[model samples]
Each structure stands twice: as C-alpha cells, then as structure tokens.
Target: MRYAYDAQSGQCLKFVYRGYQGNGNGFDSKEECEDQCARSLYDFA
Candidate 1:
C-alpha cells in the first residue's frame, strides 16, 4: 500500500494492491490530516 497526502491543503489518499485509490480534501488542520491517515493505516496491523 502507498499513501500520499497534500501538505498544504491536507488532502489525502490511500492506494492499495492495484485497486482504485481513495482521496479526501479540505482538512481543518495538519493534525487532523495526520490523525486521519494514522487511523486508517492502524487497522492494517
């Protein structure tokens, strides 16, 4: 899996195993962006 996030706008996405990627935009803060991605990835463990 690969993840890419926009640091400026806080848009983020996760791409997995040749499937269609997911994306989001317009976060209120950087902490929110990091938190969202961390939570999403945490389930993989």
Candidate 2:
C-alpha cells in the first residue's frame, strides 16, 4: 500500500501499489506526503 496527494482535496490518501512503478504525485507514508505536500498548503492559507 501507499499514499498519494490529492490536489483538489489537499490531503494524503492511501491506496494499493500495483506492479512496480511510481505514481509521481505523492507516493509515500501519509505523514511524509503531508509533510512534503499537503501541510504546505495550509501555510499560505
């Protein structure tokens, strides 16, 4: 499983990783995704 960042929702969500590839959005632990992606959204808000 993995997590990805949703741009419209601005959140890190979980999902199953299929095969062997990278989604290129925010594939990582939810905490990492939030720390690296989602949380920053609130900084400007």
TM-scores across all candidates?
0.41, 0.63
- lDDT by residue (1-45, candidate 1, tens digit) is 455565565456543434445446334455665777667767875
Please give, for residues 1-45, the per-residue lDDT of candidate 2 as tens digits. 788888888678888887576657646588888777845677778
Error of 1 at 43 (Å): 1.1
Which lDDT values do the candidates have, in the order given?
Answer: 0.55, 0.75
Best by lDDT: 2
Q: Candidate 1: which stretches are off by over 4 Å?
A: 1-25
lDDT of 2: 0.75
> Against the true structure, whose TM-score is highest?
2
